[model samples]
Target: MIRHLVLFKLNEGVERDDPQVVAGAEAFRALGDRIPELRFWECAWNISDRPIAYDFAINSAVEDTAALQRYLEHPAHQAGVALWREFATWVMADYEF
Candidate 1:
């Protein structure tokens, strides 16, 4: 399986309650049900107060590289990414397990 992880930090001055941030978060949350390639999915806001913690996270898995590719290319995923691009910076990693 391929595990895909992403961590997002909201842009400076952007609050969690901001409409764009909320919409961007909801967009990612909905991907679990919208994408067929996902074998597992978990996404949520960070509960930590630590300075190093990211504001949001996404932990998901797929069957293989091809499945992972499909997830990344999926229209729903693309839309979510587009929304996030406006208010956040993120990092991602994918590895086979």
Candidate 2:
């Protein structure tokens, strides 16, 4: 399986409570039920106030590279990405276990 992890940081001047940001976050949160490629899914906002901390995170598992690719290319995922692009940036790491 592949574990796909991502950390997201909101753009400067963006607030967590902002309507668009909330909608983007909800969009991501809803993906586990909407996408079958995901064997596992978890997303949450960061509670840390540390400067090095990201504002949000996604921790998910998929069957393999193909499944991962499908998840990446999925329309729901793309929509979530488009929404996030407007207010945040992200970094990710994928590894097999």
Candidate 3:
């Protein structure tokens, strides 16, 4: 299996309640139902108050590298990414388990 993790930091001055952020987060929250390659999916806002904490996170898994690739290329995923690009920047890590 492969674990695909992502951490997102909202752009300076962007708030969680902004319409674009709300829709982008909703789009990701729905990906488990929309994508067939996902073996696991969880995403949410960060609860931490630490200065270094990211604003949001995605914890997901797939069968392997190929499955991960499909998830990345999926149209729904691409759409969500496009929306987020306007309001946030993120970092990611992927590894086998």
In candidate 3, the residue pairs with backbone N, CA or C atoms under 3 Å apart (3 or more residues apart, or in different chains) clash, namely none
Instruction: List model 3 lDDT by residue over 1-97, tens digit each.
Output: 9999999999999999999999999999999999999999999999999999999999999999999999999999999999999999999999999
All candidates: CA RMSD in angstroms? 0.5, 0.4, 0.4
Candidate 3: list runs displaced more than 4 Å.
none
lDDT of 2: 0.98
lDDT of 2 at 7: 99
TM-score for each model: 0.98, 0.99, 0.99
lDDT of 3 at 78: 100
**All models: lDDT?**
0.96, 0.98, 0.98
